[model samples]
Target chain A: MIVKSDEKYSTLGSLESELAISGLKSGSNLEKLLKAGYFVVTAELGPPRGADRTVIEKKATLLKGYADAFNITDCQTAVVRLSSITGGAILVGLGLEPIIQMTCRDRNRIAIQSDLLGAAALGIKNLLCLTGDHQKFGDHPGAKGVFDIDSLQLLQIVKGMRDEKKFQSGEEIEVEPRFFIGAAENPFADPFTYRAFRLAKKIRAGADFIQTQIIFNVDKFSAWMERVRALGLHKKVFILAGVAPIKSLLMAKYMKTHVPGMDIPDEIIKRMEKAKKGSAKTEGLNICLDVIEKVRKIEGVSGVHIMAIEWEEAIPEIAKRAGLLPRPSP
Target chain B: MIVADIKPFKEIMRLVKNYRKICVIGCGTCVTVCHAGGQKQVSEVAAQLRLAAKLEKKHLEVGEETILRQCEHEFIDSLEGLVQKYDAIVSLGCGIGVQMLAERFPHTRILPGLNTKFMGAPTEPGIFWERCVGCGNCILAETGGFCPVTRCAKGLLNGPCGGSQNGLCEVSPDTPCVWQLIYEQLEAQGMLDTMEAITPPKDWSVGQGGCGPRRLVLEHLVEEEKDKHKIAEKVLTRNDCKK
Candidate 1:
């Protein structure tokens, strides 16, 4: 196959043919890290709302080598964005591993299965199954939501495709997708007592790694981890503590007041507001480092997932400060 | 029960503007009980149409009628004689009632005066909550009798989607998360073990998924009528043979 000088494959057909010969193994590097007993680090990469390739390419350049893998978000917050498959393909072309996030909000089973096959064909190894944010919170509120299968069902379907070499309908696949499946859990959400049980349910649904919602309340997260340990679930899957840096006082207040499933403590808000005039960003970074340090010491925590949102530049410093630098090669 | 809300008066007036004579028909069952479209509402709509037409100096004829049940043929048969008296009909019944009126009086125009909301029941004096989606397959046995198919915004069957906070849905503070409710109910009953099992993907074909309209026929009733027809045919054949 003759490759382009620019390395930008225009069509998926060509990409598929090229990947077949590239000898890129169909498994996640993050999985390898977890198995090797390395404290892994991952971060989120939100796709642009429009067809702009440079937006992700630029962020990928900054995020490369700072984390084991990047989670390419699929229409995060229910707003329309570049498809996760396309974004993951772009990251793959740039030689970065992407854990493509699949949501149950916009596609039915048929579409979901087709996209899974495509993601596999594009050399995506990691898959995160999310029920996604409700469409009411996003730009298109009038759109019809297609939650044909929730996240648990999605995990089962992916697991069936991978392990059984069969589709959701029990039909055989010519070549099954090999994905290190992941699922999200929230410990701060209401009915907190049931949170660990839900995590156990995700593990049963074939979640290889568990990424939790961003944590600001360390005491609550520690308690949740305690429940997880009580159930003996830590042995089953890798648990990554999700943490995000608050860039400003406004973002902190908004996340506390507006965002659902987030627990922002009053002290964190007070700390953010009291940051020295020109050094709030540094304070936010410090707060994030503190969280990583705290969660890293927790018994069951296997890694930390830093979601810097639009502040990708802060990841390298955060990772270095937290002693997670020199990302290991799998 | 089916819940419906009347369309705005301006929209109703616009729909009936071209017709010189119109009749406002209301349902006496579901819509009546819901206070959306009943005898009282029909009279009020008719009077409002008259007053608006008079103010506009437009000559118009308006009539009012309330049927016991617009969905049933027997209840709406009383309007047979009055069907030709009006140019158009504005039905204040649920979607099924409007369709029934349209199906019965094929030649006349049947316009809906209310927007059919959902299959629900009154939660309070003025609030109604959707309870069932008629998904054909019921998993309430496993879910502690709470219908997540209808009450949940995403219709998630496995568990709450990590968005429930303080027992309320993430979509709205006023909307209680059905999964949280289910969890609490099951926990109280000491049945939390039931929720641990993963619910498989729903069989959507049982509902009106890819299939068209659904129909239920009582096979025994149909067989009884067929038996009578067979007897009549046998007697006719004997008479023909004798001739």
Candidate 2:
């Protein structure tokens, strides 16, 4: 049974007791770890395209004790997958904390609000809000993009629902969906300069934590972290630097060339190319470990979000090699 | 001005494939300034249609006319004698102009030669960008003059969305993220505090979603009411003369 924390749940008034035993609290283990100043480590899992609970369960079980919490991607890259809410709920049932990802690519405000309420009712605590990948990149290239509210406003709306106990329309919610709000950032995308200011806007919008896009260039990321620290934004929000284990030289080249926001460095690509036959995966893991180590040392970075896309088996080893294993208890 | 772009030459030709005699009407106002619909544009379109018909071995008679404004009945009445000879009229104005032509000449087929894009101004020669969605609510004072409704991909009122990078939109690298421009302008003007205040969801009722065609009428402009005011002035003048 999930016991709601009295301190945070007391704001629920009389409804606290009814939800105390079953409902998830606003504060999550990830939040607890960040609050306690412990170096947090989280992982991401893309929900399968088909509805097979066994696949989700296996992945969650693999990541259970290693990651503080695992994020279930919401139609990542515009490809429809098992709903993040359902995947998150399944993970919850399997004794794993899940960060349900929600994107504005597919839903309008009514659907977004309804799903948020449903997710909360299902005992899902953590939510990572995103403006999702454009539908042009997805399997359904002809699909319409429903960006009714972009990620920033979604963050504000969720924060309002959680903190002010009111909907976007100002209607009072009988039972507020207490969520540890999170938002994503791509430091390498463009105009290369305003990333930190955009992050500041997200923080002001009530984002409790931030997860960045995949980091391949340590120098650029460190520079961004320096800017983030300069603005004193590090103290305001928990920033989780994103690190993805490149599986092969081909994958690295594809991401560097094809992906819009990814900034994979030439040196890393050359290093991967120099890898001996059958050693590319090992080299990739080494690159991931090196990035984790370098990112952990950044002043403003609070944690590392490991996105071993479709490579769940590498996470346990990557976490252990990065010295992020032996997960702390909240 | 409501800016527009001319449809592709082939598409325009295809639209008038059935008509042997076509009259192309261009607006002298907004479309003219944007270079989409004007006297020159009308002549160019008429020339292209004649050339296309010649190449296709079809006999075609193309005429061109420029009106002060196609949306007004006064300007549209200029086509009274000229329209009867043509099988169809291709309007080079915005959507308003095309509809106005249709409303005035119900029996004549009205085809839009230009695609009505948006209410915006040309940033430079031969370039125009949409600047307004006509949400009927103006928040330029709060936004440092950059409109999120038309400029932002998601129409977010609060601030920049996460897809913003290096000050560009996530949808396309070519599109400069307007929110970044707003932020810089606000920061430069020392009015960043205005951005902190959450802008409520717009009241769309006054906008495109609320109802039928929007109308605005000044009560004092009514002709009958003006006559009453004229009579009242006359009575006051007579009383003044007696005094």
Candidate 3:
């Protein structure tokens, strides 16, 4: 039980009231759930490319109670979309929690800080900082990328704003925008031995929690988790294993072959290929549920972040089948 | 050294079509070494321009010249009176040389025949890779001598951003991730701890992010010029008083 379905307000007044209720950093529902020792389930929501609020409203309705918090993506793959902050506000108005994903690909520090403030003011309390996908993968490949600050710096900056009551320039902030900060890690990427150390860097930089790149190979993820546990980094930050329900065999093959920093086991691809025709999607969902089940048993994994890319409809069913339904009250 | 590429012939022709007499000038330093603009290149360009004019049945006079360094005032001064003979001068020099030529001969049209690329060195016989962006503040000592500003696509100070995989950048498979090289270099030196420490945001104002154009003034050298100017000013004032 998060916010009541009928209770909705889109203003700083409501946010201030929510903040006043708890002495916690952000007092966000997700943070409250995590603090209460609830195994969380978060999902990704890609904002529409055009200015159609109904598109998001519909998606929000589908995912209203499935997860502890919904992550509103920021121009994922560098393709333009309705801004994450705007999308977060929409979810806020719908009485749902949103974890706004902020990427370093498009905005500089000035814009980043300004947007963070706006997001917080609009009742957004959770954030996931990332060094976004390269612009070449997007529709606007010819566009200029403005990664004035990397994801680590972004986390540090947001932390400074929240905890220290100051901006990156060391200027005092009157009303600091408190946020439950999160960062993304890709353990599947190269320099495998260094991944744990990198996660430590994110934690030191102010990441309260982390959602890793979509996991396809549990053995590698578990190995990385063992390293994380060795360094005691798992104690410092909440770790969420990222999972995505594969839509089709072609998608599975494409991700394995083309997507960088993604490791899809050959056996997983073969499993999807072997699925009877028209049953690939069901098999994909099963695979996702299997990953979720495996990751849940791993020590130090706080939750599962289901990234159902474009398949938002599957989330409720996945949540129901995974026993993640009836989300705990904040 | 400055790397540059010669402009397309059609663009060069369009730039000089209005001028009855045009001189193609090449720099003898970086451009020569890069085999882009040199004495030999100037000769070839002059020949091509002359032949093109002949084919077009247009009456045109083309001259070729090469200076030791078009960027230096002394070298450009050597061409002083002779440069005025041409209606326009097409400079096949790096951007600095083209601007230097334009500054010296303000009245004559100084057209650029080459697009200055970057400050870099050749990796092999023909391929040149950018090594520095002249950000003014150098952090190479801490970075194991690999420049993230010049090499990393995002110019990230704390980097190798998830895009680094298999030692290559996500931007392009051809481009090697400089952070990976820096990490390895630091690891070899037993400085992996250096990579772990959080590097703060860079002061970009020292680089291109600064206001307007940037200049480096050597105070010791500039003081001597100021003294000379003072002496000349005093001499002029005395002459004026006498007059």
lDDT, candidate 1, B47-66, per-residue tens: 99999999999998999999
Clashing pairs in 1: none
Worst 10 residues of 3 chain B by lDDT: B203-212
> Can you write out model 3's per-residue Cα lDDT over A237-285, one digit (the tens) per residue?
7788999999999999999878888999998999998999999999999
Give stretches of model 3 more than 4 Å off.
A1-23, B229-243
- Which scores better on lDDT, 2 or 3? 3
Structure candidate 3, residue pairs in collision: none
Candidate 2 residues B22-42, lDDT tens each?
999999999999999999999
RMSD of each: 7.4, 6.6, 5.5
Ranking by TM-score: 1, 3, 2
lDDT of 2 by residue, A179-295 (tens): 999999878754456677778888888788899989989999988878887877776777889999999999999988777778899999998999999999999999999998788
Give each candidate's fraction of reference contacts reproduced. Answer: 0.79, 0.26, 0.61
- Candidate 3 positional error at A134, Å: 2.2
C-alpha displacement of B182 in model 1, angstroms? 0.6
